[model samples]
Target: MRATLIDDLPDEKLATAVADLVRPGGRWRKVDRGYTQAQQWIVRWPDGRSVFVKSGTDALTWGWLEAEIGVYAAVDAPWMPRLVASAGDGQGCGPVLVLEDLHEAQWPDPWEDTMVAAVVATLEEVHARTAPAGLPPLSDRRDVLHGWPLVARDPRPFLSTGLAGARWLERALPVLEAASARADLSGDALLHLDLRSDNICRHRGQVKLVDWTWACRGNPVFDTCAWLPSLHAEGGPRPERIAPGQPEFAAMLAGYFCSQAGLPPQQPGSQRRAVQRAQAAAALPWAARELGLPDPGDAPREGVPR
Candidate 1:
């Protein structure tokens, strides 16, 4: 995915902004991870310094980039990625983010025990930090985070996934709804709403989290609850085995994934549906186990860690 001949790309605005730090003769290669609207790159200057760049390819990513920059500016933590410089604001060539290069860092794979422990420890420290001003609280996403209501409003999307038959879904709807309603996502802990293997890297004994567009504040427990589903899908421990004992929160997580697992991606090359379905596979069964609900069947899982 290397874009040789730097002159062939249209990064002039971003290049100019970082000209002092990243010299003109720098080379960059696309990271090529899909599911994002931004073009990510690892750029190396002739002077031997390197930096990661995230340039928005569309309006959605432009807004996301702006938010991510704010998160980096507001939080100074060991787990937070270093912010080098930023440019654009949706007015010129979209928004761009410059960050410390993490290419040499180890990204999680095979769900190693020590790495998992490091991640959890990092999260614990994150939770202890006082949230930056203007960060939204977890309660803001109460209804929005609750997925059973969405499924209840329109069961077609959930049903299409074949994770549960029509009869099974109908029989299980009441339990799902009740369990979700019992979830109260309220607390003052700083939160990383989006936690996945790709957004994480361990460098020099520190776990750095990239992609801050989804950072916020919420129940500390909710942060781990939300993460374990993806962890489970990636051959990590089940949500119950790791965090355990948050049946209501587990139901809410399941509902959120199930509600969108069968929907169409809003953009081309997006892995939204597949990832959501894969997460639903892990979360639903975990929720059922916690709540003693009936089986919700199964479907072939997709979007394992990459």
Candidate 2:
């Protein structure tokens, strides 16, 4: 019963955990937003200030959390939440990050025209910022980011997902693989590889993007390219409507999701594979439409929100 009232944590435990970050009277509630393995909290002080906090407990979660903390420390852009405080070793492990609470922010699920415009505008702002030094280039991530080549090596996994029919796979895989190779992802701009509704919010009349662990330096278009597919998956406009005429990007994004959709879940109980299938479902058609390739008649509509 106490847990029900306090979001599964006692107020005393919350205060003890972040004693240095907040006043003694503050209370905290666990937040269940985004796809992070780190524990999240929204702590409200007696003075009416609130902060968002996350503790890096999981091994993988700690690494990503460290990267996010570095991005926060390096960039002072309005497109992200203000980093309030952090505590841990210099290395990226066993630490907690405190950020300006965005509990009041609007998470645009059923996106509107104006909201979409806000996100696009925010992306432009984000891309205009130079990536921090020491960050890896987008090209360094090709092994994981590019997928059509893997599909070509062994079509069985991708074929099992049913995003495209066997005939369509045999015919279209080469074009997509080739197009993926041609997509120039090289640039100095900041790229948020993960872009979805859960990672974005409209706050203080502007777009604030969270989840920066997958960030890298790449062509600015990569931001828009990666975003549009997930946008459509969540009921927004098609990829072409927001940013027209980037077939290479469409192909790349298509493969990024399609190749992983049929594979077993990387993490137990993760819905990411299903979401990838849905993103593939969204991207394949867009790629065909933009590239002037024939319709992927074998494409299945069996995908969920990415």
Angstrom error at residue 41, model 2: 2.0
lDDT of 1 at 249: 89
Model 1 ranges with Cα > 4 A deviation: 1-8, 88-91, 298-306
Candidate 2, residues 80-137, lDDT tens digits: the string is: 8888887653233366788898877888868889989998988989899899997789
Write down the worst ten-residue block by lDDT for model 2. Answer: 1-10
Model 1 scores what on Cα lDDT? 0.79
Which ten residues in a row are the worst by lDDT in model 1? 1-10
Candidate 2 accuracy as TM-score: 0.88
lDDT of 1 by residue, 95-120 (tens): 77888888778888777889888989
- TM-score for each of the candidates: 0.90, 0.88
| Per-residue lDDT of 160 in model 1 | 76
